[model samples]
Target: MSEVPLPYRVTRVRPETADTVSVALAPAGEESLAPFMPGQFAMVYAFGVGEIPVSVSGIGDHELEHTVRSVGAVSAALCALRPGGRIGLRGPFGTGWELGRAAGRDLLVVAGGIGLAPLRPLVTAALAAPHAYGRLNLLVGARTPDDLPYAGQVHAWSASHGPPYCQVTVDRPAPAWRGRVGVVTTLLNGAAFAPGNTTAFVCGPEVMIRVTARELVHRGLAPHRIRVSLERNMRCATGHCGHCQLGGVLLCRDGPVIGWDRAESLLSAREL
Candidate 1:
């Protein structure tokens, strides 16, 4: 394997949604950064605030962008950084959404709140290769309408991308809103899922994953067909620090994306 790149300088920052901002980084002495899989995350090191893991929100031929929300200390620091500020980056690590398996089958994506960050890459990758799958449905749930990530892009994708569907739900709706007003699961009630031939990618909080996984299984999806992206404290991307250990599995290495059956024991364990 090649050595990971070091810190890069922030070249530009753009806001995607109300609470989310996309940061563009330029590698030292270079105009571009390495390409990464859609769902991989980079270990970002913010000066004086320590390091944290953030998912890559978008990638271009020349710039690497990350869509981040102000949820914790590191994120808050990231939100406060000005353009031209320097920050360290380690990876593009972890297993990503299994795009190959999604080929020729219906693809259902369920994302909650900032969980949309990881899924955004998978969506972009799939859309770029339109014929790789059958019908594609994206059901997103946020705290409110303003909390939805990539709102404009989601609308555009729904409009021009085949029969692709995008539905958004919010726990609280604005007065002028016409979309669903409830948990994301509520939006799944009447939707059709071809479990036998479909694959589902779910990323969100633990509670959301639990509920979503149960519903998918109830809808006849095999345990192995449901892939989830899990989050935990990670000190190293290479599984050296032991911060992301879950039973015999080290989330940093074994997966951030894991099949339901493979995660059964870990997810069921009391302390994991």
Candidate 2:
């Protein structure tokens, strides 16, 4: 049963941007989906089409949400399914961002484009209990104002509490756009974290991961303390197929989240 797909009924479909949708699903049966920590993903099957790995964007009281961008055949079919429709789901798989390892220290979250999806649950976890960690900084980068997801929540998180702040930048901004415009690293200058005591979780395109990790290291955050999520290396949701390889790690089972010290060499090389 663990290897087979289970049914999940789509309960909500939220339009995050022009091309992106956040699909919320609930178990089709009485059994509840197993709980998942932030950074974990599930293999979603689109019935007639195929299956793809999607990260858990939000864990609601009765549902699990994944932010889907219709990038290809499988994803487009997944995103096209309406509420009340059913799709196949399996897993809350892979290693999560072990927050315990970063306990009592500053948490810096850097996300690019849809990469923010995987990190959303962690933001919720940290902000709900603000007393556990030091300063919490969320830095997000998007291609344009039109492409940014979590628009409403991003504003709310930055405004809510003093210690947790969210800074966003875009590669291109339209006229009258008010926020900063630059790569995500530009916001690093104003981020409040003592390099020695900060733990960073980064996710995005490999280039962005490489640049962001390099920036964090240049600022003195321990290379080992910087964690990154790799999507390029995760083709199959389970390691059984043996296709997803990021350097020596089998991303489906061993990673998708790896330490900067371990990922740096692989990321810089580009093709592995």
- Count of backbone clashes, every candidate in sequence: 0, 0
Model 2 alpha-carbon miss at residue 60, Å: 2.0
Model 2, residue 52: displacement in angstroms? 0.1
Predicted structure 1, TM vs. truth: 0.91
Q: Which residue runs does candidate 2 get wrong by more than 4 Å?
A: 159-163, 233-236
Residue range 1-272, candidate 2, lDDT tens digits: 34777899999999888888999999999876688888888988899888888889998888999999999998898778799999988888888888778889999999999999999998888878788899999999999988889888886766776556888899999896798999999999988999999999999888898999999999999999999998853445677677787768888887778899998888777477
Cα-based TM-score, every candidate = 0.91, 0.96
Leading candidate by lDDT? 2
Q: Of the candidates shown, which would achieve the greatest TM-score relative to the real structure?
A: 2
Model 1 misplaced stretches (Cα beyond 4 Å):
1-5, 16-19, 31-34, 157-163
**Poorest 10 consecutive residues by lDDT, candidate 1:** 155-164
For model 1 the local lDDT of residue 30 reads 51
| lDDT by candidate, in order shown | 0.80, 0.87
